[model samples]
Target chain A: MRLLLVEDELEMAAALGAALGRYDMILDHAPTLDHAMAALANHVHDGIILDRQLPDGDGLSLIPRVRALKSGIPVIVLTARGAVDERVRGLDMGADDYLAKPFAVEELLARIRALMRRSPDIAPITARIGNLVFDFDGRQASVNGRILDLPRRELLVLEALARRQGRTVQRSTLEESVYGYDDEIQSNSLDAHVSRLRRKLSETGAGVEIHSIRGVGYLLRPSL
Target chain B: MRLLLVEDELEMAAALGAALGRYDMILDHAPTLDHAMAALANHVHDGIILDRQLPDGDGLSLIPRVRALKSGIPVIVLTARGAVDERVRGLDMGADDYLAKPFAVEELLARIRALMRRSPDIAPITARIGNLVFDFDGRQASVNGRILDLPRRELLVLEALARRQGRTVQRSTLEESVYGYDDEIQSNSLDAHVSRLRRKLSETGAGVEIHSIRGVGYLLRPSL
Candidate 1:
């Protein structure tokens, strides 16, 4: 899961980022409300962890801005104020959950997961197309109940395609999903992965087809 | 799935809403940027279908606000400004996908689904606690792969608790999940559901246990 954390303190942001990373979450740190807003404009996240007291403005104010875009994204407000009224006020202002200062990372992770589970728009954990099933969390794909022993890169390619089954995923989007922001890519690396994935799907007798959209990217469609 | 649609045109919103609803999506309409922002601050949405020409301002202005909150939430900008440069600019400014006016509702639905599937933070579709498995999409639970026949309300209660797995889910959150926003819940309705669910879990030899925290909410943890 990707998260945008609006916290001013450098040490806290680093610490929180490290902790959240262990749980397989990518966190982008925003030191101020303006920075947070800038980050939000560029990327998408599953959740936001906001610090009530930021260098630029009160984090509570950012909540309304977030609500304006997608009210369903969970916002966990972090504050040193442990007063019951403050907590109540935060909730009243639309924070999904809260955390007092010096909170345990484990508790924070638990709360984040709880908020995510309750999020109505969260896509299903697994996706099934034709006779093929993909367990995204496990990074495994199965056809007709038989697991396909796919290599890591092939699985990532398959994930990018399967996630948007029956639709064309742009070439850049697939590259971003498969390779990290800093990862180097050869011209034909993505094509190689897609070709191998295509062959594997056919060899397994999986009732799914991966079609390359000429110069665009690739699409996964159920076999006719 | 839920979506926030920011469009000033009433007829188009209604037509699009009806078409998207057939695919099991709930569309919340916002006539202006103010309304869209207000809606975003309150409810959650899987995606945002934005119109570049709004009564209040350019819908492009709202993209950053949404990105601020949940960067992962897909934004598909819809407008009559079909100029090639306009589309590229919208995407450059953080819109995930763009569609021009006079588009087919079928195409819109397909685009929306593709965006939802591409979302990275969509929580896992299925969750497991010990030998008990809960499929959020199917709204069913199984023990040792055996389907547990649970009533609607009971299943909802179980879902609220199981989503958190070992953590305690607050009472208010659980109520909102099980009942509608306008549901006039009785004092003991939740309690009744929990009682029945507990009995059913024990009777079915389910591996998970639901523990109620006094004055708080319920939690589902593996049976010790």
Candidate 2:
């Protein structure tokens, strides 16, 4: 996932950036509220990590602007202050989740996945084509109640296609959802993922196929 | 909104119950985790306010059960412990929002409203028919950019019908949404609210009509 980290603390930001890289997430750091808003204006990040305390202004102040855009981008507020009122205020202003300082990076990763699952336009609840079921929340696919143990990237590729089932999901859109913004896309990496996903689905009697629309994108359809 | 308040504190529960009543929200108080679970098993609540330090177990633990039901019932964790880790843990466990103790009742109300807006099946985003727009998030209706200042119950009645748009929303469902669970139905109260709403829409040139389905419910459709 591509995320913008609006944190003033250089050390925390750098540490988090490296940690999230292991999970294939790219982080763009914004040192101040102004920079955060500017970054948001230029590019769309899948999610945002906002520090309540920023150099220019309070992070809670950014929630209104983010919500005004109505893109439903999930925002996780980070604060050293773990006061109950502060958490309530952040959520009321539109932060999807909240994390206090001194948190484990694993927790952050888990929260991000949870937020992505609830995102309407991003991850659909589940998609069914014929007998195959792609459950976005579980990050798994199953055929007739039998699970398919596909790798992480493969599952992501399926999720992108499943969300747009019966229609083509552009190659660029699939890559954006599967890989972080700054990740160097190995020429055939997407094809590799889709190929493996297709094989796994067939092996499980999924009754579905991933059809490539030459030079365009990929579509998920029921097999004859 | 119909809510379940799972807090052991009788005084706080009573205060919040009364406050929410003023806004036409019904509160079902469950003083313990067991009671909360039992209440949930028997009846449905639009949302829940959970106290983390429950008598039997941690409030966060209940989130799994709530989510397991796949009802999409929003859970807001309330706690006196202001520790940062606790807040993150609550959210990671699936609490929709978190509130520390000593919070303003108004903040809780705002968070509840926010959660209701995100709930797809419960409260839809915005329903648009011709020039009329029912903005659920703002809890307001506008026509040609001009806002119609609708009363609380009137707005709720409009929201219930607008969500189903072309189809009729049953009278029972509309009553459940507009009035509290125990609020006495004054025979034609719903009709009164709908009448006012319909007239307001016409007065504002909102090209739509609320059609009463005889003895059934109400449907909103574009006016000829």
Candidate 3:
């Protein structure tokens, strides 16, 4: 996918550019809002990574301009710490999503993919993989339209994994997202959840695998 | 609207605490992430103001912990400049909203309102006043479930009022949220929008009065 990253900081900009590039996606870096606006005027980008504060001015001013021009192009605002008004205003201004600064490259990639997919429209309430359908808000999983009663923790775990379908999610991220921050997770708790879930899927003959990435994380993909 | 302020900085924390106290809400202050977690475990708070950079650890880790303990408690992360990752990670970790450092107390108060009204499972998307119901996401006013389509600006203006329900949404906040940042709104655009939407609402035979606060914003109240 083509991306435009609008950021002023040199080192962070270069690092983000390189990280996205590693995913085999083309990234165009715009150092200022003017450059970003010009890039918007010139190119067709599948996605955008916008920094809330720029050298010349506050980036919020440019949000409506991009929306006016690109209309539905996915724009993800990168906000500095504790800028709540900026985050809400950005969303109200038609940004598809908002990301805070001092973020990890992997988290950035995850948010990018999620926003890019939803920018064109609201994501379907249910996402289907193989024969399994997951209802996001309802937090239920079904196989061939049959509701599969799943545990809350497993469901949260599954939702985290499915958001990154076909891509790996790090163990730490999963632990933090699915479990409360201070929960003392047993060494094999995540593995145990995955094992139980895998068994359940296999029982229903759903041809999907929660593949282990070993030391990194796990991925949910159709059985190969 | 009781709040918990979890921040490490002594002076800034005290200032924010006093500012929030003036709003007549309880302000529980904690200096570290662990202490903050303990505070949450002890009592329920309607809203939380968390500093991302706490002495003990990163504040992003506390969101889920707090949320699990008190569902629908609006958390506004207090982020320092240049910490994009912390902001994004906080949101992805289920923070209801974020606020950057160096923000106005008024803006923070406004955000607190927005977040409180929109917290998951707390506020209904559709609000009924007399016979009229406002659908925020759909941006429409309904009379007994019959849709009343409104123009974008007017719809937003109506929502701004409806969010307050029986109370008033400050005009400044209404203007900011509707037109967004960089809106050089001249004339009585806000009032004009409110007038038109109010007329439309009355036309549907829903006896809902949009009371003008005169120099403030508008209020939505059921008319007998």
Candidate 4:
């Protein structure tokens, strides 16, 4: 997940950026509301962690603007003020969650998770194609109750395909989901992983086939 | 997840730290094999990201030591050498995964996820208590297919309780899971969240009850 953290304090931002990265969530830092607005305009984010105290104005003010720019994007207000009224005010102003300063990183993570859960776009916990059952949450795949022990890249490739089974998943989308932004994309890496995944699935009698859509993307479906 | 990253390059360590933090993964940096050993002895980590070239010795040499120290701990070797032979050598030496330098962080994360999923300790994707069903990965709870709209903190409290329904979850464990490592725990905060959660559950007719075990912790079970 990609998140925008609107925090001015460099140390705090660094600390938070490090914490959230470990969970595989990408974070973009905006030191002020103006920067935050620019970031929001340029990039799509799964959620926003807004610091109430900003150089330009209260972070709470950004909630309505965020709602205007992207309706229903989750926002969590972060402030040093732990007052109940401040939290209520932030909530009333369109914040989905309110977290006080000196909070635990775990608590912040939990809040983010909770908010993301409420999103309408969340995929089901599991998906199936033929005899293959993939547990999206557990990151495991099994066929006939036996787990398929696959290499990481292969599994990731399968995951991208499995999530959109029977539908053509564009190559760029698969690459984006499987590779980091900084990764130097190898033109053939995805293909190699997909080929290996296909071999493993067939060997395991997963009863699934992956069809490449000539220069476009790949699709997974039940084997005829 | 807490990870031990044994990398000699200062910039590389800093970049990885920042990147991994965004995902909510805690990284502990070790500049040398000695420091890495010390960290492993002192703290339990979910995995290790090993850099092949270290000041003290070749990182591959440390794999056996790591395995001896903590069996079943996943290790991923990062090296400038991407040769197939070198990759094989690293795997033979006990590295669970090997990534050539310039690899995407997303690939590393995927490898970690795949390895963790193979562990027996992974929890089910969802848990149930009476009418309340909690989706662990999605971080949402529902009562008989009706999603519960909850404030973040209250949901977190309920999550900690619900995961181990019918059993006592220690206060420290609940606090640790709910709060961050740096959070200053308020004596009454847990109580406040639990009380609010109880009220909300009752209002929603969740058919579950949270029981406090005095000084011990809390438990969730079907409401009689």
Cα lDDT tens digits, model 4, A1-224, are 56789999999988997897666556788999999998888766779999988999888889889989888688998866558888899989989988888899999998887676445333433455677877653467778667788766677678778776655566776776566333459679888889888888899998999977654577787787
Q: Worst lDDT window (10 residues) for model 3 chain B?
A: B115-124
For residues B96-201, write the lDDT of model 4, one tens digit per residue.
6666688777767767776676453553487889888886654567787565656667767888887888999999998888887788686889889899899889
Better of 2 and 3 by TM-score: 2
Candidate 3: where are CA atoms >4 Å away?
A: A1-224, B120-224
lDDT of 2 by residue, A102-127 (tens): 88787678777766755433435678
- Which parts of model 4 have CA positions greater than 4 angstroms off? A9-14, A28-44, A54-57, A120-122, A136-142, A145-163, A179-204, B1-224
Writing each residue's lDDT as its tens digit, candidate 2 over B1-224 gives 57889898899989998998777567888889899888788665789999987789888888999888756899999966568888898889888889888999999999998777455444434455656766555556667556778777887787767766655566777887776554558798888888888888888888898876555467777776
Each model's lDDT: 0.77, 0.78, 0.72, 0.78
Task: Give, for candidate 4 chain A, the lowest lDDT window spanning 10 residues.
Answer: A117-126
lDDT of 1 by residue, B29-105 (tens): 99999999999999988899999888888999998899888766878887564385576556556666666687878
Across A123-222, the per-residue lDDT of candidate 3 in tens digits comes to 3233445556665434566675467787766777787776555455668767755553323577888889989999998899667788775555776777
B-chain TM-scores per prediction: 0.55, 0.80, 0.54, 0.56
Instruction: Give the top-scoring candidate (DockQ).
Output: 2
Ten residues in a row with the worst lDDT in model 2 chain B?
B117-126
TM-score of candidate 4 against the unseen true structure: 0.41
Candidate 3 lDDT tens digits, B19-132: 878888788889998888888888878888888778988887887787677765677787775575665455555565566678788767876775554332343566878987
Error of 2 at A108 (Å): 21
Every model: Cα RMSD to truth = 26.7, 16.0, 18.4, 19.5
Worst 10 residues of 4 chain B by lDDT: B115-124
